[model samples]
Target chain A: MDTVHYLLEGFGTALLPINILFAFIGVLIGTAVGVLPGIGPMSGVALLIPVTASMTGGMDPAAAATSSIILLAGVYYGAMYGGSTTSILLNTPGESSSVVTTLDGYQLARQGRAGSALAIAAIGSFCAGIVSLIGLALLAKPLSEVALKFGPAEYFSLMLLGLAAVSGLAGNSMTKAGIMTIFGLLLSTIGLDNVSGVARFTYNIPALYGGLEFLTVAVGLFALGEVFKTILHKESHDGNLAKVGKILPSKQELKESSGPIARGSLLGFFVGVLPGAGATLASFFSYIMEKKISKTPEKFGKGTIAGVAAPESANNAASGGAMIPLLTLGIPGSGTTAILMGALIMYNIQPGPLLFQDHPGVAWGLIASMFIGNVMLLILNMPLVKVFAKIIETPPKYLIPIIIAISVFGVYAVQVNTFDLILLIICGLAGYYLASNDFPLAPLVLGLVLGPMIENNMRRALTASNGDFMVFLEKPISLAFIVIAVLWIVIPFVLKLKGKKVLINEEA
Target chain B: MSKTFDRYASFIFFIVGMAFMIESGRISHSAYGSNVGPNVFPFLLGLILGLLSIKLFIETMKYQNERKEKEALDYKKFLIILVAAILYALLLEPLGYIISTFLFLLVGFQTIEKGGWVKTVLISASFSFGVYYLFAEVLKGTLPGLPAWFSS
Candidate 1:
């Protein structure tokens, strides 16, 4: 009863004319980001943060945070819907999460079923979105209530677990990812100390006192890094796209896909709830699961509607699921969510147990908007699938420069300082070189965002226990978290040692 | 993975970690009633980072026989854009948002593709002026206006 009441109130906030417009723009851009080759949702959300900040500059702070977050979150899920378009039409996935969709989706397109495949993907994503939202609505209050009981020790270990889970699965080598994570953590220590009111590594520089702005690092690493890669590599997305003949799926096509969609949504949602396992992994797992479950598993790669339906549903659901940890536990499950968390912190709104109590409007409104955004996607995607297909041919020449301009503009608009712009460029160079060399950038961003909180919690725990090193081990929840964290890293390393091919989340 | 890059990166990280550990020790240790202070976290992180750097270094040695693939990278284009971007940043405040952005985009578009000057200039101009007017005038957001001398 209480959940229903809160959800209704959320709809009230979501349905406001301005919020609706924000949602529309968010999804529209989100789809474009998804369709475009180089930009993933992480950079998409990062790029939009400053733009949203400037756009909502006129509003009251709380309302402003809510509105901007609404748009950013829209980009996050709307990307899922758009990624399937390229996989089905172009035989090249727009983002890594849609990689599995390409296996059967491309086959279907070759068979002149591109339109149905696209339509099914949209429908599956819609269903998965609803399922994930309902799951989020039902679980939000209870999870936050439980999280409120955590002490500093538990919080410290939990955050450590978050870091470990991400580092383990981010890139090819656990060692490289681990190094990036530590590097990020080290970078986070470059500012004034909060507990002692002392400067640790500022070197008396005015800008260093506030530490490196996460926005600069993010936009530089993701947006600018991507731009530099495109420029240097001469990679272009222009290609022949398969024609989307029909906008509607036939009755049998829908019937065959229904089971996969339902199953994939549930599977993806749960995978999404885990820290570090993102939509790419969720989609991968569901496609494999569907293969195992199907009676005619041989028909999988040759254009089965179930193949397109399942992975598309799973990725969308997983994105929805990823929001759970961020909103309820204050832990971002993926890179995009980490950027989202940083954006929230920028608004002076801490996301955690108290989020529901302190900013119920933001938490609930985001959930309701997701619902409306999904419906809008379903309506907009079916007919516009052909139009979106045309986006594949977008010239890298113009897009590249404009993205750079936006990154510079966005960072400058918010920071209003030259130092940050310089830093942004430096970070861009670092992002390109590091990423090309097998170093994962997500863990580094994660480390930066969670750095202060991790330090604060670790100190609080240490102080509470009279500086005992065993405090983390002494607490049961803390111990469990640390143990799991260790296992997360060790298991992956051991598996690789045994010559087992481990699946890494490249989309991060 | 490039073993050479990893080796250099690890070595640098090793130094960075050592630096952090050494520097954190200089900060006043006890500011509150509890013994734990600002330095402990960084000190611990730095030590672990130093150890990880060593681990990464050794790991790089395992793949010493790795082969290098040669692909033609457009260093000229990249360098030009990089320099242009830095110049754009340097001149942003002095020349204002409109002029610097227009120049950067023009150079960027030209560098990426040589011809269609009319189309390129139009796009570059529209984006620069379009964004400025939309942000500063329409949204009432702040941006550097035309240079004082130029406007006056």
Candidate 2:
């Protein structure tokens, strides 16, 4: 069937009462997750996986997957909208992607235009979401069809490129990021070897045979790790909240932002489609681009409506763009997408070229739900933004502990094992120390999620080639992928050697 | 960062890599039909990790230790909450979800800040009971309920 026909079917599924409710709840929690400082989109989505799992327990596997993903994707983009709320009002970004928004968002809020800034952000985000969804719809079939022709060799190389891209842009130090990636890959090797059915690193430990649980590790690293940071640092929000006056923007204000939103959506969508570059980078790039093209550049960082409009739109669009690589190529470009891929895998639904053909219901349903979820976010944020703003004032005292409780509950509910709970705590400690020391956690998670697939594909390719290592170079597509992967890692290092600053994706 | 932390982490990672490389040899060198073996992937990864750790160590050696202005961490509070979490995990299956969760939250709330005893109790009770009822009762998912003796 054509894309339009499949999309209509997807809308039928998405608009189902349960799926719509899932989207609503997902975006609601997502906005809350974004508004709160301690948790990010990664942790927010991770924490909810098990809860959503149980919530959809009674449904058929296919229906369950659709509903759960609808909610999770809602959280992902809903966060992009909610993040701007804090940036504009508190000058503290709710999530890293919103960091650029604070440049002009806070300035606008200071100028008593907080309401307009927020409204524009919501509008920009809504427009960007629709644009990217349209992009995803147009690109999904073509991209997956191309990916379907890839041999094992090409697949291996492409995945390697994905890993390399993530590690290259992950943190302040590429070496550290590379190490974390390798470490995660090593950790993934602990389970039973899929090909040989031989235990490699299990050492007869029963739990080890299944490998480390991804959900446990994720929650510990992102959720508990952030919690530990809050506890140790004793973070307190003492900044006076900027008063939000006039909920709607003036027509002139809206008119000024139209071009910026459109441009930001296009730029952000392209950036998001590329592996490694994420919403954080997209927002930064769009902001810079807007500044360069703006007739009144001086108005930027001083409450320019375009300033709030561009980056906010860009980040949301970038998130939508990131989904393309994941759904079509089975390569997650960012940390959050990696977690989302893990969730998909948990449902026994692999996200790759075959995903569109095998699970059209899931693929199209998710795309459709994003459209519905974006509307919900725009509607929710427009009137109830003040309620969300109050969430920033939630004392860390109550917030921190409850987060701990939820983490414990979520992990236990899913794994149903004491070992996982213990491991969760240990990972939490490890996550805190590693993150504080500038060891990026995203690459590690990405590596862990992609590790098995990379190894399996490598083995398959080598098996096909009778162990010839040069097979990767023999295939033109594979050779190109490998070259790009090498360039991805090496170019950054070269630029650093020349004292040129390479933009890093801190949100990843 | 911390120079000492990096130095230690690199050293530790080096050991982990070496251990993986050495232990991978225990796995059979070949899978029945494939020319490649299960051990190949981990072995290569371990070797690369070891080399990277060495690189990291050497890089750390070149840095002059700049003492950063350290912020006072709430060690006592953190340690207390951490210990409570550990205990909570340990006692979860034994004491049941509600009791263990309630106790953990109560401890966690008080440890983070001293006041709000009554509010803490209410929240802890509501959350623990609420989740248990919602999950076990409402959703029909399995979670350890009250201990056998207490329930009986």
lDDT by residue for model 1 (A39-137), tens? 999999999999999989999988899899999999999998899999888888989999999999999999999999999999999999999999999
Q: What is the TM-score of chain B alone in each candidate?
A: 0.96, 0.97
DockQ, cand. 2: 0.90
Provide the RMSD of all predictions against the true structure, rounded to 1 decimal.
1.0, 0.8
Q: Which pairs of residues collide in model 1?
A: none
Ten contiguous residues with the weakest lDDT in model 1 chain A: A235-244
Q: What is the lDDT of residue A37 in candidate 2?
A: 89
Q: How much does candidate 2 score in TM-score?
A: 0.99
Native A-B contacts reproduced, model 2: 0.92
Which pairs clash in model 2? none
Quantify all predictions' global Cα lDDT against the true fold: 0.93, 0.95
